[model samples]
Target: MRKTLLTAVRDARSGLALRLIAILSIAILPLGLISSYQTSKVLEKNGALSEIALLDRTRQAAAEERALIQSAFGAVEAISAAASIFDSADIDCDAVLSRLITMEPKYIFAGFVDTRGIMTCASNKERANLSETPFFQDQFANPGGLVSVRPMDATTGGIALNVSVPVVVNDDLIGRFWISIPLTLANDLLGESSDTANLLIFDSEGEILATENFGDDRRTILPQDRSLQEIVRGQQRTFRTHNRRGDLRDFAVVSIVDDTVYVLGSWEPRNTGALTGPSERISLYFPVLMWIVGMAVAYIGTNRLVIRHIKRLRQWMRLYSVGQIDFSQARLQSAPEELEAVADAFRAMAQRLSEQERRREEDIEEKTTLLREVHHRVKNNLQLISSIMNILIRNTDSEEAKHLLRRVQDRVMALSAIHRYVYMSPKLSMVRADQLLEDIIRQLVVVGSADEPENKVSMSTRFDPVELSPDQSVPLMLLATEAAINAVKYCAAANGGKPWITLTLQDLGEDHVKLSVENSRSGLAEEQDSDTDHTGTGLGSRLIESFVSQLDGTLEINALPDRFELHVSFVLVKDEGDDAL
Candidate 1:
């Protein structure tokens, strides 16, 4: 089994399939890989640059917002130092703070905490302790200085940015002044956008101040964003990263202004028109797709053009080896050039073989024709010899010599008829047995009627048309003819001269035939059947026995005082040889 497999693999046609597959794989693989790599690089390069471009624009926007917040916080000092308002007697703190709130809508609250952390000039009578807030404590630690504590909880709205400053009277601490601004204003400042650009502001302490994607149906801030933490810890001014939903990637520019970290970035959603459309995506992976398609095409083409054709060619050559030359079977339609050329050559070679075969057949036919002509001429020659023998028989004085010459004449005439039948036959070496028997019987019946005119012998034939090869026909015919002649000649001597001969020839099945000649003789028994036996030692009788034995047949001879019967049964041949038809 292993040897058979190895042989199959080593076969030329099998190797051709392998060679073609290898060649195509080698040619297409690198091309696909290189093309895919270059295309993806180009796509990614342009995409990152475009995101960075949008990020830069967004960074500028973030900077403007950050400056606004910082300026608002910076102005808190001037607002707190409004001596016209704060230092005035019977100060209406609520009206003044409410007026400031009306002036800057972003300021959610305004108040002053004294050295005891109590609201002295309060915006609201009920107020939270400022000393607990980081910026309020941080301000008193550095008096008259402002502190921003962001990512702060708002009192009534959203997340807030808190800024506080310590107020002093001649180096004596008075209170801490502070204001709160909500980040919702910052979100309102930068409206929803088409790009993946979003805003993020975290404080210096690595706390997430705010996150805003700010688009239709997009989250403003993702809870527990680890990527944001990585950005804050890392030292990259502008870092590139993909979003949590891997498909969308961003290039972010982190800017620090007034102690706030502002991150501006744009993401490219990998799934959503990242490279315009499907054609662009295909271009990015063009090499990979091409490689796959190339492999498929190579396999199918090799099977069709190389392997299949080679197999068919091998099959045809095998048929040709056994003399089955069918040129049309060798045709390979719509094949590759090299294979087609081979098929063309195969067709040409098969054509030559067909022509050669045709010529050989013609030569054989010509030889058969010449052989038939030879038989015709030999028949004519034998008939001439029989005519001469007839003259010798008529001129003879002795009865014994006359009888021998007549028997010899009978033999010569039977041989002449044999040759004549062979000449008339379509094939040189085959003759129809029934026709030869009928012809020979007619001639001998004429002779039997001539010698005894008063007892004219009647002839009846029963036979099938059996095809006999050249060697079988002559011997079988002579044996039958000799039996008929002896019966015809002796019937008068034994049965009062009124002769009636019945010739029986039949297909006996199993490639065999039976020939029988029964004749009435002149005297002796009143009735006799075919099984009745008598012996004769004449030359014709001996010749009949010789011929029958030569034909490998069974001969049954029964000679009664008044009748004689002869029967021979034999097999026929049907192959192309001396014994065949």
Candidate 2:
């Protein structure tokens, strides 16, 4: 089975389908992989860059927070130092506190303490316990020095950053000056944004000082080693982070003093992981869709414009290969430039093939029909000539007359030989003149001598490959027959015969034909020469002239003692309407 299959494939032309499949594979696979990879890379880069941009904006917000906190701390330090020079003799605490309240620093509370750490005056009097303040206690322990602390606020219940400086009299530590600044300014600095998450401020001990939520106290400070925290601790610069929700968040923390750490955190959501869902879906299916569309179009285009026309052309070619050749009209409509040119070539080929076959068939048929008619007419003419000679022979009493009748019979019989050859041949518009003449001469020798044949006479033909149509061939053949008979019968080598006949055909360089018949024979009788130009010339001579003129050809007659020669020149005019026929 395997061997049979292999043989069938070899006979059939196996590689066409495999080659198309390979072409499709080669064309499609690399593009598919490359397109998928490129699409993936594009999506990846877009998502990553968006995330980076979002983180950058959040970091900017965080940096703004650090700036706001630092500015608020500077205000608190200015107020605390200003309180140090306040009255000690008049002790007009109310007047001094009212003057300090006019400073108008945002979200700051200022107050003062007496020599014994007793609260004297307060700007936020409802919330102040100056003697118990963390800033006041720290400054009293380190006398004549400044102190700052992030402490729980008594009024708003949020943390406040407190700054303190010693009140000195004559360079002696007398009392303390203290001020409080709320941490809610961190959230205020980062303005309203929907995609921005809650901002929180945390103290150095990781206690929530301020937040976007009012009543919430949950501390959300990042670990100390987090990117945001490290950046704030190391350089007081901005940094960004990703939370558990995959939100890009940023924060800035700055230490206003040894005890005060200000923090600002801002978050914006990053969904790079979510973008893959749509991108992967498109990547998985886009190439398959392209291939399906491409092949479908290829098949349809190839079928309508290429395959069907080629099949028709192939069928026409097969018919042309055989001998039928009857195509009168063969045309195809192949569009698209290349296919149209191919169709034009096929049409031309079909026309040529049909013309060739038609000419071939016509040649065969014309030869067959013309040869049969010529042979039939020649046989009838010979029979009539023979019959007429027989009648003349009976009427005449002279030996010469009887001899002429006998010679006429020999010539008639020779003409009959040519007819027999034409009848036997498959197509015989013309005969090979040399072959016909040789056979006729041999027959003449056999009949002329009953006991012995003339063996010393030689017959040689110098004819070119001349094909004579029936009109030219018939009379010329008969003339050669008659001449050869006269040569053998009347030539002058009495006992030892050395006669010779040479027949030649030349092309004449134009559309003319020349037929030469030569024989080494002595002069013809005087009667034959007179008959050549007159109406009483023998039927053979007259018939030769008549046939030659009928074929639109000219004839020449030459006579000699050593040679009886005739050279015939004629144009081989083709029949009119032959091409159409």
Error of 2 at 262 (Å): 43
Which 10-residue window of candidate 1 scores lowest in summed lDDT?
526-535
lDDT by residue (tens digit), candidate 2, 1-581:
99999998885454344345457767898998888778767766765665456545545545655565555546545655555455565555556555565655554666667666566666655534546766455657765334343454553355654555666556776666565555555445544432355555555444454555534433333433454344444643444555434555554343434435554545443344222345456665687778777767666666677667767777877876775455557666646677667767776767787777779879868776875787788888888888888799889899788877777787687777778767665545455655676677677655445312653556566666555555556676676666555545544442345766666767776667787766565454444444442244666567666756665666676666555666777776543333244
lDDT, residue 559, model 2: 61
Q: Which stretches of candidate 1 lie above 4 Å from their native place?
A: 1-332, 397-402, 492-498, 522-536, 560-562, 578-581
Ten contiguous residues with the weakest lDDT in model 2:
267-276
State model 1's lDDT. Answer: 0.67
For candidate 1, report its TM-score. 0.44
Candidate 1, 466-557: lDDT as tens digits: 88887888898888777887777756444344467888889988887888988877555423332123334556656777898889988887
Most accurate candidate by TM-score: 1
RMSD, every candidate, angstroms: 14.4, 20.7
What residue runs in model 2 are displaced by over 4 Å at the alpha carbon? 1-296, 299-301, 304-306, 309-317, 320-397, 428-434, 444-456, 462-466, 493-497, 505-512, 521-547, 554-564, 573-581
